[model samples]
Target: MLVSLTREKFEQIIPLIATGAQYAYYWGKWQDLLNRLLISVVAVVVILILDVVLGQGAQALILLLGVIAGLYWLWSPIYWASLRNNQYRRFPYSGFWRGRILEIFLTEDLIGEEETVNQRGDLVINEIRERRINLVIGDETGFEIELQAPLQRLYKAIAPGQIAELLVLSRQPNLAKIDKFTDAYIPSLNLWIGEYPYLQRDVFAEVSRQLGSDRSRANLNKNRVRKPPMK
Candidate 1:
């Protein structure tokens, strides 16, 4: 199921959108922009109020806090893009793979420890757990791997036995040596199940369509082979 994917092929298949559009999409819509702007404005106003009320003694500290907020608002987009570029750096060599989801189930997972105040006002650390869906996928060769993802709205539609697609990466150009893997794309559900969104949605869809056609043809050939000749 795994097919060789060179860097040239990867770049062609996984195209990145324009920087402006990508930033807007990843950073969110007008609501997010307003929230960030509002926080920066609030911090500046608070700093001014502190300077007037608390006098010059605390001006340095107050201004520093305001500057930090402003800086975060200004540099957030660049910081986000830097994080997004990680996929390119991590997977120098990769391959496309198609498989079938063999199993699907939910499992409770410990997320973190949260501090809560009890009725008596005693603070206690409590374990936070959430149910997450886990999927097991395999190829016709019997090579199976488990892919775990947080339950999202689209994931509810995914069932066992549906086709699953993913990009398998390797340190070397060897398909057998699977060094790492990108998130799994469930074409049937039009959903990607993973912690991070590695692939561009439009480009991923294009690649999936090509693979789907190939799969259809393969099935047709198999069916033809299975049919008995006329007596």
Candidate 2:
């Protein structure tokens, strides 16, 4: 009888749970694009060869198939790469769009190290720190906005166990840039929201048995605790 209720509970909160998982998954995915790039390149070449071998009449069809596959493989890494590299292509934020809804987790509790900054001319930009920021989000992609901005001050002042909420703006992307910080990107499911609450090494081990979020099931299992998992 308890099992039935447990399943029901999982179902009821599945949306939120899925959101957390997605964030966790994509966050890593954004970093995995490098490994996948070579594969994507090979796939494109193979598709082109097959299209030519099949015949000219089917050239358009094969080309279409190749393009679709190429796009599917490239979108995430491309998007993340573009965003990370482009200073102007900042993550979309509430001020940029309106009416869009989102959930935010205050991971200040999971603080790592303080980020340093240098004044270049007059702009205040981060000087690349050794800490990892755990910012997760759940979004209905169809909404007008493309990039959802991080809650800046809150993220800066995050503490353990702090959770918050915010509304996002509605806007469409006219152009986007690649991120230079990361080397690759991957795609993820929509269940990372709840998973993150336990991803902290201290928290993960303590609640592993309770949440079934053990290393065996984690999408990110390389890290043991303080150190980052292999990138």
Candidate 3:
């Protein structure tokens, strides 16, 4: 069920899935920058307090620890930002690959938390949901690929055993973006259903309708089963 697509056609589909609102990109770079900045500020305050309490003898030790911590906090953000920028710039020039989806699953994670006080003076935990999709796809030649995508409604529309295409960056295969997907297989009908863009919102509604119809037909056939006359 693999459909080979030209680079031009693949680029056209890239925008549908390659959105800027990915959870990984946000947590990996932006949130990371803020976290490091906060840690560095706290470290500096601690070092100053230690210097005053321990006097000149411990000043050298305190300075050494502070320097190491400062370098660590300062380096991460710079490296991450540059790497992220380069990835985005190279996406348009990446190669494309197509495969049939063997399996798909969604995962939800609590990446961070916010604290709040309730009316009764109780502490509340506000958890952030980070959703992602894991997909296993295989090509005609039997090569299989495993991919994970950040939170997107498109993942819900896709079902197991559907044909899908992906855009693969030569150096960064893990960041491969989903390009398109076909409808699920109907067992009784023995057919592959409609094709839709990966980002289409109406796909879920259409899939629900098709599934409802199939369920009704299956129940009707089961009720039609005749029992033999028994003693």
TM-score winner among the candidates? 1
- Compared with the true structure, model 3 gives a TM-score of 0.36
Per TM-score, what order, best first? 1, 3, 2
Model 2, TM vs. native: 0.28
Candidate 1, residues 1-231, lDDT tens digits: the string is: 888866876765444432453465457778777887887888788778877989878877877877886766666765675566555546678788889999998899998898999999999999989878889999999988888877767677888889899877777877677776667887777777865555566666777798778889998988885568889
Off by over 4 Å in 2: 1-9, 15-31, 74-231
| Structural similarity to truth (TM-score) of each candidate | 0.68, 0.28, 0.36
Tens-digit per-residue lDDT, 20-84, candidate 2: 33334444654366555666678788888897788787878887877766765545534443333
- Candidate 2 least-lDDT 10 residues: 180-189
**Candidate 3 residue runs with Cα over 4 Å from true position:** 1-31, 53-64, 77-115, 139-145, 152-231
In the predicted model 1, the residue pairs found to clash are: none
Residue 11 CA displacement from its true place in model 3, Å: 29
Residue 117 lDDT in candidate 3: 100
